[model samples]
Target chain A: MKAEVVVIGSGISGLTAAALLAKKGKRVVILEQNRRPGGALKRFTRRGIPFDIGFHYSGGMGKGEILRALWKYIGVWPRLAVLPFPEEGNENLRIMDSGKVVRAFFSYDRLEDELQRVFPGEKQGIYAYLNKIREISNTIPFFNLDLPLTPYLHDLFSPKGMSLAQLLMSLIRDTDLHAVLSTPVFLYGVPPREVNLTIHASVAHPLYSGVYAIDGGGQAIVDAFLATLAEAGVDILTGQKVESVLIRGNQVAGVKTSEKEIYASHVIYTGHPTSLLDLVPGEIFRKAFCNRMRNLINTDSMFIVFGAIDDPDTLGDLTWINYYNIRTGLDIMDLDLRHPEKSIMINAPGRRDSDSTGASGGVLLIRMSVWDEVARFDQGVREKRSAAYRKWKAESADKMIEQAGRLWGDAYSRIEPLAIGTPLTFRDKLGLPMGATYGVRHSMNQFSPGVRTRLPGLWLSGQGTLMAGIMGASLAGMVTVGEIEGLEPLWYEVRQCR
Target chain B: MISDEQVYQQVTQIMAEEFELEPESLQPDATLYEDLGLDSLDAVDMVVALEKAFGMKMTDEEAVRSVRTLADLFDLVCRLKNRQVTKE
Candidate 1:
């Protein structure tokens, strides 16, 4: 059967695009490679202990935010059980910087005050940086849904045009501020430094307003999307890997899956854009476009420790998310997982719905490294691994657990490791190219692909298309579908969504 | 009642698809751990896959410990389905 649109890869972007297009009365069928629908946001349970894959929490889910409106419009907000991050310094997500434990705050004002309190010597720099981010946030079209499209010239000249690293250095001479300021880039999935002020502002601004995690973790959002898609009459075909985007002359006609062919006039791809080279006929894209995509650096992947701490006291003390840098000298830049010269420490106790502070339990995602360290073992088969490689992975997890014990104090000792997902796990299980967690690296001054592709009907979406994380991926879906249906209508829907 | 051949085929398909192994490589007598080298995570995925494929809910988690061979899995699934059928 021919669909109005064939949405590939059922991540946030694909689901968002399918829902929106389906709402517009377009026949859409989302083809997911995995047996399950959620792309990065899929949650799984082991011995009844729940763990979220990509999704931890989201910002910009607050009132009047474009992300909030989009979620409501997509029927996601109502289904999701979201809560604010702990505002207090002790219980709140802690950042260990240069032997100083700086707690993160959800409120922008609170964050600023805390930063000022901690870095009293750099008061002027702190104020300037906060003001700069807010200014950068203003330039984002999605942030102010009421505003018309942010003009290209505005983008070229604004603070969004500068690198967050460059901007931070220029504004604050303090090294700690530089590391702390760019931590938002990790939310979008890059380790740090590569993210520019524009990408940084759009992705980071929401967290300062309010950041929230779901009650059932990412599963809640995925389940909501499934219900919405069903209600909207958007057919979902899981485990259907699109082998190729079939073309008729110069335009995209449809796609062929492993089992059967799905014909659609339009195809919105939500996977890593690099994978597109295999699907779309190579001749359709220009030489430069192909090369850029081929060499497009993936965002840094992570070594996630998905565990449950049953100790009620420790669990209560633990927060769901944190960017804990255990390594001193404040080198957030190079986290060499091999030598353990640098490390990213985060202790998130996976929570059961019964308790807020994860007294029941939760998960912590520690940034292991960029793909370089684990790329050697990428060729190994998933089901069967060489004993040597398996031993290495086991040893690595053991070391991380040991580090957690050191960094998090006595609470960490009681914590038991439930599951360890390495970069290889993501690459094998999730199908992310090189296990890059945030999709295509959203680097400053780099050429990232937009919604439109040279191939007429095949467009791009997902994290790579716009910003990273749920908000970015959702916006990207809008951008891609807007290319087919008018952007004005999406904007109108965004405004009208209550 | 499901035939032994039908049960074997279903078991083979689910295990093959889940593990990304060739179906022909799996024999009824072949051990899941030793022959297919299916690890702990792979076993979890296989169980989920089995539930979907056979449309029968596995009652006993202990079945995972005992279901070592493809034949063992076939019998486990058949028994689960048979129990459901009898109950229904």
Candidate 2:
């Protein structure tokens, strides 16, 4: 088979790149190792009820927003039904230690008022911090369509040394306020002490604008993307694992899957950056570049408990709100997996549906976990794990359930654990190294690889290349295609949608 | 403390190894883009290699952006190293 561009891994990034490239009159072929596409966006079913794995809710989908404009430009906006979260208290932060709860609103003015109300004496600091986030987020190129595209790379690297922790401390003095602001860290999987301020602002600024959940979860988004690709005449080959990227001299010739080889002018790899080392030749990349990719620190993984809410009525009006149940006295800067109860993000995926009944909705109790917790049981296959591993997983789930029950009373008491997922589950299912939830960590210490590679025709487009999450991954695809098809024209078209 | 000559040698060696340039070809005044054949992407990887080799953090964006020749990199590394020594 032959194509102008062969995209590896049919994840969000791969799908986005393939769709955009095909729309630009290029013959694109997507090769996915898994039987199903959508990578992390793929969902699972238990007892005939659907549950989202990777995506839940996102920011910047409001009218004229960056995500909205990108989706419109890609022709998926018409297919999606954007469900915006309530303007007041979309996310609730519950400090378990003190039993204090703070609400985060969608609008910046309302969010500021809420923060000021919660922390009585920090009005000035709250205003300054929110304004700073807006300022830094604007410096990013695609985040603001009005900005010039000449200094895209330079703008991203401008605020390199400053950490989120340092930035927060400089602006605010209250420790509790700092913890509240740091709740967004879990979304990016980086600690406040290590994550870059610019990266943090990029993730947080959008949410400050608004938060929204899609009507049909991640599966719907995947379906929309697949439909777009189909319309663009891009061929998708699932269950085909790419063995190696065939390189002739310094340029990419094509990719060789397990069954056969397909020739192409360009190859866009959307897997974990380190995985590329195994596919390409040993000497194709510099020793320093390879070493950097090998030593790149990954974001922390999760221990997720998927369960059904027996009765949605038991939860009352709190059913739809996302909860960040953080333990008191725990440093938000450094999260320890040993104490899972210390920090947990409780999400009700099914509650996003307007017609969701009590029995059909599902709840996900996700705790940030390190890979070491399940490393001892890594030797066995997914279906046949050791007895010790099962015991540990059951105990962990029970403890998490107990904590949730205590926090939510009778509503969580009826919650039954349908399945448990450790980092290994994420690794095997999502193909993430050590099951890093959000690919490479955007930290102060490490530099992530760029979209362009040392190899002439091999480019990278994934969460690892740019930022993390749906918006970041989608933008990464646009940026990679923009690099190939010319950025000014692409940006101009994207701006037209706004 | 490492002398200026050692810093120059180390920077040139890294450039030679990482960028596939000959050690003799790395002149002090040779332009990075035209002479050494390093593009914008190569500039990023070079910074990573230099940081790893010296065990120093190249946090100053302005200093890194100002590099156009081998001599500029040597001076920047020396200045950062001296600052690190003084801090200790």
lDDT values, one for every candidate: 0.72, 0.84
Compose the digit string of candidate 1's lDDT tens values, residues A385-493.
Answer: 5677677776776676676777667566555667878778888777788788878777652446666776688888888877778878888898777778877767787
lDDT value, candidate 2, whole model: 0.84
Q: Report chain A TM-scores, every model.
A: 0.92, 0.96
lDDT of 2 by residue, B4-75 (tens): 889988888888877778888899999888888788877777788898899998878778989988888888
Ten contiguous residues minimizing lDDT sum, candidate 2 chain A:
A327-336
lDDT of 2 at A492: 86
Using TM-score, give the best candidate's number: 2
Q: Largest lDDT belongs to which candidate?
A: 2
RMSD of each: 20.7, 2.2
User: Model 2 off-target regions past 4 Å?
Assistant: A158-161, A327-330, A337-341, A380-383, B5-9, B12-36
Which parts of model 1 are misplaced by more than 4 Å? A89-97, A150-160, A190-193, A320-323, A326-331, A338-341, A352-359, A380-383, B1-88
